[model samples]
Target: MTDTLLTPGAHLFQAVEAALAGGCRWVQYRDKSGDHERRAREAQQLLDLCEQAGARLIINDDLALALRVEAHGVHLGQGDGDPAEARRLLGPTAILGVTCHDSLPLARQAVVNGASYVAFGRFFPSRTKPEASPAPLSLLREARAALPNTPLVAIGGITLDNAHTLIAAGADTLAVSHSLFGADAIEARARTFTTLFNQHSST
Candidate 1:
């Protein structure tokens, strides 16, 4: 299991490179509501950076841009796109992730519809965006028990301080943002997260 971090609101190239350098294996280039051309361009830049760093890159909510860049994956929220449609468009090898929030039903549906993984979140206080629902730690426990083979992702407000709790709750991956970028020592904080991830995996 690994903890994935999405790039924060900052210089895309710099952030992507920094995260990769700090050992972030998977990075999602998530930018909401930007113009098509700009978003496409940014996604491409991030993809290039990911390629150089040997890290997988996921584009958020834009299948078209993802397809254009041939990114590692595409992450879709409930209202973003039909998963089956995305699968059809992206072909068999493309990785697709669906935001399940707190619903096991939605997670099951996503898996059936060809999602590679399911994301649940806003586990703690979130300032990035208005989360419609808050998932509890128990949700991860239940989902893990129900969907044992599926890769489960925990998102929202995750930090080094509480990452162990989420891992203990059966979260396979922690999707983080602000906390990683907000630290004064980005590399050191990322190393802390990597160390925590190792410790969690060992336990």
Candidate 2:
């Protein structure tokens, strides 16, 4: 599995290109800027780049933009509209992910509601969402046992220094933002994550 999940933030294009160059197959366009026109334009651009790389682009929130850009899918948070509705909009072929925030019930519900993958965390202190609740590794372990077939994503402050623990505890993908994109060497930082996943797969 290509588990390096690069989530776009401030430096959208730079972040996506660098991640894809490092062999990342998944990129989530996570713009919270609320500039509808700009977001649509960027998503359309990313859709082109991802298609060329054979990577998938998941738009964060904004179901309309995901459909307009015809991205791979849309990721929904606590109140980012209905997952089933998003699924209907994107059709059966598109990927649909949901943030469960360390709750098994929520994860299960997301799957029931037609989510393609489930995400958990703020595992560590996050530069992106510092006030977000911390999700324990125990949640990941339990989630793995609870949802065997579905992939689990671990997010928030996931640096190389602590990524191994999440992988070991049962995270299939690490959703990283600034810890990845803000680095002086973005491609190298992305490679570290890809390396971690590759090593895990080998073992």
Candidate 3:
């Protein structure tokens, strides 16, 4: 996930490109700046970068922007919009992710509403959404058992030290922000994260 504050202006694309170069296959453009024109331009640029890297770009909470850029998908929060409606517009192939916090029922509902993946989070103190409610590791375990086929995303406060716990608990994806783009060596940090996944898969 990309943050406006962390990678503002030209640094945004640079950071994203570095992450992609480091084997980060999924990129989420998550700028809440409310500048429609700028957002559209940035998102389109990100889509192009992802395409070149054989990666997928997901626009955060912007169905229109995702559609305009022909992005691979859109990640919607609880109040963003209807998942079913977004799914209908984005079509079956486009990935539709919904934030379910720590609620299994919400995750189930999101799936019924056409969500391709479900996110849960704040497993640790977050630099980017500090006030967001913390989700328990048990939630990921339960959600995985409940929604075996659904991709589970764990967000907030994910770091190299603790990310493996989330994966062990059943998180298929880690929606990181600060720990990634905030690093001095963004590509190296991203490569480390990618290595963690490779290590996990090998075990």
lDDT of each: 0.80, 0.84, 0.94
Which 10 consecutive positions of candidate 1 have the poorest summed lDDT?
A: 1-10
Question: Comparing candidate 1 with candidate 2, which one achieves the higher TM-score?
Answer: 2
Model 1: C-alpha RMSD to truth? 3.2
lDDT of 3: 0.94
Which lDDT tens digits does candidate 3 get at residues 28-117? 999887799999999999999999999999999989999988999999999899999999999999999999986899999999999999
- Say which candidate scores most in TM-score: 3
lDDT measured at residue 134 in model 2 versus the true structure, 0 to 100: 90
Tens digits of per-residue lDDT for model 1, 133-175: 8889999999999899988999888888889899899887778
Give per-residue lDDT, candidate 1, residue 91: 88
In the range 1-203, model 2's lDDT, one tens digit per residue, is 11223334445676678788887888888767768897788888888878989999998877888988888998988889999888887899999999898689999999998999999998999877687789999999999999999999998888999999999999999998877777788788889899999998899
RMSD, each candidate, Å? 3.2, 3.5, 0.7
**Deviation in angstroms for 119 in model 3?**
0.3
TM-score for each predicted model, relative to the true structure = 0.91, 0.93, 0.98
Model 1: residue 111 alpha-carbon error in angstroms: 0.4
Off by over 4 Å in 3: none
lDDT of 2 at 185: 83
Off by over 4 Å in 2: 1-11
Q: For every model in order, what is the number of clashing pairs?
A: 0, 0, 0
> How many clashing residue pairs, candidate 2?
0
